[model samples]
Target: MRCDRIEDLLPAYADSALDPRERAEVEVHLASCPACTSLLACLRAADEALAVFPEVDPGTELRGRLVSIAAPRQKFSLFTLLRKPSLQPVLTAASVLGVVASLYLLNPGRRDFEKNVVRTFHRGVGRVEKLYAQAGGITGSIGSFAENLYASLRSSNPLERDKD
Candidate 1:
């Protein structure tokens, strides 16, 4: 193996993680290349130093906080869905649909029902449009009023009046 390839495998060789064939190749390269040998020595020294460092236990409060952070979170499930009050509207809609399906299966008057639903949806959209228009008109009037007030103030200022 080349010096570069042996250098790349030095850390794994130090950790005893390399395969026997690769380790032998790296050993041969390291013996022939002083640079690769030094690099391997550095990696081994780092590993040994790390191994000798004493493990420190965290404080009780920090341990508690870490345990809380690392604890398995509550996963979303059907029971979680049932627990959420915000899902009441969804549940109600689902139940209503179930009832409608049963009724349609029995009576088969879904065309009229679909038409009514579409009409109601269109009415809601129209109301939303009217609200947006009203909001736009109000904003336009407020903006115009602010502009007029600013112009009048500018005109009434003694400095501005002198300039004019």
Candidate 2:
């Protein structure tokens, strides 16, 4: 294989993920190319250095801390509506709906009441207008009668009375 192709496969070869044929090709290139051989050696040395580190262990204090964090959640009952993160939004929405429903129920007739008050006011105005017109007619008739009576008392000429 070409030096470039072998270099591309070098990482996979180091990880042992290459097929037998690909491994053979990389080996052939490594033997022919001194530069690639030295690069492979460096990569292996780096891998070994990385692998030399020991695995991390959680101490008793760390384990106790983790257990304390997890203990409160371990007894979660499936039917417990209060413990779920997903239920908070639903609970909040339900509370809002309940408040709105209660307000609506408490004043169910408020709109009808306002409409009734407005209608009654309009009806009262109409009746008052009718009474005012009737009063004006009555006043005009009384004034006409008084003027006629005074005219008759002041001038009793037959021709004038007939003319009036």
Candidate 3:
């Protein structure tokens, strides 16, 4: 890891909350990195110093306060659906709209895509036909040239044919 990034993670590393792999990585980095080691040492000393704040004893009033604060919070359940009675209609409407929207959005390729594919297919076929015609023309010319060479060789007077 880069020295700057390792230096940034030094505080978290000193806290020992980092995973084993992360701790090893930091350890490897700290071995070669003096700046990060110094930062880690400082964070460690600060944490050790903060440990002096002794835990406060909770009084009877504190217990009452905690219960009062927590008493109104109801446990969650699937039946919470029926309590908000007005939300049900809106949620139902939204769900229907979501279904319609999903069906439209998730539909197969549009007409434009199909049209483009067909057009590309026709263009590719046209190119292939043109290539085939050009090849045929070249091969036909070669065949004619071969025939003329054969006829010329079949003649008894190969040199006299030039005088004609």
Candidate 4:
């Protein structure tokens, strides 16, 4: 194997974490590569230096706080959602809008009013379409004007025009 591949396995080999087959492959590579062997020696030296510092368990309160911080939050609930202060106004507005829409849709006496609303919507849409068509025509004219201006500027030779 290449030195680069063997270099990655050096740390695992130092800790005796690699499987037997992997350990054998790393050993074969390390035998041929002086750099990998030196790296493994350095890792072992660092491990020995670190081993001098004895591991200590954290205090009970600190461990409790850490566990609380890492623990998952309470499961989702609709009551929790409804209790949010920030969402109160939004929920109220949605509720009011729902009531209004249901009332309007469910009213049998407003059948003629609904037809009038539909007619007004159609009329507004027609006006908007006409305005859009006019705007398109205006845009085409502006584009044509710009093209003509650019062509005129390009066609006019300054030297000839000055001589004339």
| Top candidate (lDDT) | 4
Single out the weakest 10-residue window by summed lDDT for candidate 3. Answer: 155-164
What is residue 73's positional error in candidate 4, in angstroms? Answer: 31
Residue range 43-66, candidate 2, lDDT tens digits: 899999988978888799999998
TM-score to true structure, per model:
0.36, 0.34, 0.30, 0.34
- In model 1, the number of clashes is 0
lDDT of each: 0.88, 0.88, 0.86, 0.91
Which structure is stronger by lDDT: 1 or 4? 4
Candidate 2 segments exceeding 4 Å error: 15-21, 72-164
Ordering by TM-score = 1, 4, 2, 3
Across residues 74-107, which tens digit of lDDT does each residue of candidate 4 receive? 9899999899999999999999999999998899
Task: Please rank every candidate by lDDT, starting with the best.
Answer: 4, 1, 2, 3
- Candidate 3 lDDT over 1-164, as tens digits, reads 99888877777787777889988999999899888888888888888988886888899999999999988777786789665888888888999999988876776866676789899999999999999999999999999999999887767576767666
Higher-scoring candidate on lDDT, 3 or 4: 4
**Model 4 misplaced stretches (Cα beyond 4 Å):** 1-102, 105-108, 159-164
- Candidate 2 contains a number of clashing pairs equal to 0
